[model samples]
Target: MDINNTLTIDGAIKEFAPQIEKTSPLGWSWITFLSVLVLFGFYGLYTQIAEGHIVTGMRDNVVWGIYIVNFIFFMGVSYAGALISGTLHLFRSEWRKPVIRMAEWITIISLLIGPLYILLCIGRLDKLHNIALFGRIQSPITWDVIAISTDIVGCIIFLYMALLRDFAHLRDYPELKVPKWKKKLYYYFALKYHDTPEQRKKLNRTVDIMAAMVIAIAIIVYSVLAWIFSVTLQPGWHSTIFGPYFVIAAVYSGTAVLIVSMYLFRKVYKLEHVITELHFKNMGIILLVLGAFFGYFTFSEYLTKWYGSQKNDELLISILFDKYYWEFVISNYIGVLLPLIIIGIPKFRTIKSITFTSLVVILALWLNRYLIVVPTLESPYLPIQDSRSAWVDYGGTWVEWSLTLGGIAGFLLLFTLASKLVPIVQLSALVKKDKSEENRKSE
Candidate 1:
């Protein structure tokens, strides 16, 4: 058996590309499903905008609710794609090469969805313009918009530049069997890429510069989210350590998402060998380390509050321990503890086990987020003396649920569609063998 045939980038790309061309029942089913979900999400968003945020749980005091939390979580998850890709690419890790494209796009697409959701939650779309006009440079929300946008732009540039080589291959190669427009795209991007001594040097330098910028910008963006909560004067949120705490949690969840996405893509595209059991095992270890760190942060955040015994802290901590204790315990156990233990064990560290563990961690992270947003506002410093007590801790309504589901589906759908467009995995090294040869000749 030719391992090269099974393991090669050309082979995987060739096979995966046909997934788009498939006109069969299941292929149509995915198209139909994605379309319906997106439409439903879009309609829900429109209705939401029409009715205003008042229909949702958000109110005067608790202006930032699930939407903001979701924004932060999505941004963090994108970081998995951005930072992990950037770090691995920078270090020249071979394991990262096959997956970096996936990582980079996930960051870009999720970053886009995250901001839209924030806008949706913000209700009045008209005032968004006012943000720029009166937008205080010092505001965390303004900083968030700027940082996330900059990071998204950086990720896109990095992704497009990296994929340029593969596009060149599709343009030049015989087997690609592509259309005129696609051929045009290949030729178009190929212009920036000649395998000359000068061009190769320029390409390498550009990739390095963009990769470095992505890392710096991603870090700043993560810090921007941390500042969202820390900049506030709330007890659990006000700690100096809050910024780093939020960043760690973001990475922990973001990495879990990448694991889940990678696992899904392997199955969906049947690129099992390319994705491999080893990738799962290695990433599982990464998650295990992150879970441990998350556990530490969780312990520290709660412990300091309970120990300090300030009046508000005391109220919130007691309520958390006693009243909201169930959500508290379950989120920790399934999200953090299970993954940590399962991944830590040699026996359970297989691909299937890791995938299952990753789902648990991701779910827990979602629950963890909901708990954080709802409980803090529920236990505000002032007591809720109102007939509409339930409104105080606004659980997500169906519209919110539909919108959120639609957004998540949209992210996954983008992956599926994106896989069909460019080299889902970069193949420039093989296709560009000619370029490399030309560069050598020029040298």
Candidate 2:
């Protein structure tokens, strides 16, 4: 199938079919690399399970370590996916079609991976069910549990709805060169969608409804996560702004991830025609706006703490500025400002430059999550007066670092496998839009 053929539904199927039907040698090599990281992560998990929390850097004073940081970071990314995709769909943005599927995938994949970190954080995994069995209404933990559970279901439905037309198209495509089982899989999931006007109306309506619901759910769920910290009596946490603060940060990081994903898929799949420089520029603008808001929120948060001058707040701020000085600067200052500079300057807003800036934003946001989790724990309300440095300071051990890498590899691996199952770009939407334009030209 010549990819340069005029834009049509059949042409799109032929163009995207190779993505599903065959894996290149480089693709297999990438998969192997990710698999190795995942296996190593599993080994780390096994060691943690066998040896208990003693082997980890977590102590009584610093009970939450990188695991909690990862949990919050991944959840933030997931919520950002939900917010961006939903808003784009609601507004019926034309440029969003190519990237929306990637955003949806980010939402589902991050949701799957994010909560696993909570399990890693729990010392007693055997009694994990107690959160559900003996949960209280007033508990933020309980709220998070319910909110995340609801969010997973909502996002899955939203993604499935988004994919339905593509599934039906693949199922019906005579030229689709895939295994019988794969075809059957598509047929079953396609739900007898025949592209009729009625079916189209119903599908569009359902997708629109799910989009709105997931957006609302994502906000509520992340806010609940923030509340889990804010409602606490601890310094650097008991603030009124943490909810909005977390939400803004999540969207900022999520936008960066989405941009990175778009860049990778566009390059790998050779989708320059579909995902153009304009898409990157549009997304970069969004990232710039988010970066500015995130920076403002970070300043507002710390400025309040510094001005209020409570002893615990003072101590926590001092720890952040003194002990975690480099991290504080990178995450709050460099991470936020660099992306703004890259995107704000017209000369620097090329696709490659924006993508590089996004990568920096991602690392900075991860560091931001670390800063939020670790330094605050180090400066607890009741200080641990211990001679042992391990008791006083928290550092991620090899096991924690391995698991973190593994979680990241797992996210990438899932995205890789998902692309093999369906088109990363929404082929149906693109074809439909192309047809609409053609019709208008004919008229």
Identify the runs in model 2 with alpha carbons over 4 angstroms from their true place. Answer: 1-6, 385-387, 433-443
Q: Which prediction has the highest lDDT against the true structure?
A: 2
lDDT of 1 by residue, 1-443 (tens): 21222333444446555643344576568867987898888887877877877666676446567676677778888876778888887897766665777778888888888887778766557778998889899899899878877888888888877877676556555566556776777788777565557876888899888988887788778888888877876766777776666667777887888888788777776767567777788788888988998888888878888888898888777767787787778777667789877898898788888888888887777767766666677667666566365566566766777788788888877877777677566665323234333544477
* Clash statistics: count for each candidate: 0, 0
lDDT of 2 at 46: 96
Report the lDDT of model 2 for residue 75. Answer: 97
Candidate 2's residue-wise lDDT over 1-443, tens digit each? 22332467777888788999999999999999999999999999999999998878999888899999999999999999999999999999987988999999999999999999999989888899998899998999999999999999999999999999889888878778899999999999999987667887998888889989998999899999999999998888988999999999999999999999999999999999888899999999999999999999999999999999999899988988898899889899999889888899999999999999999999999999898888888887775565377786898999999999999999999999999999998888776445642453366
lDDT of 2: 0.91
TM-scores of the models, in the order given = 0.91, 0.96
Candidate 2 residue 351 C-alpha distance from true site, Å: 0.5
Question: How far is 65's C-alpha from truth in model 2 (Å)?
Answer: 0.6
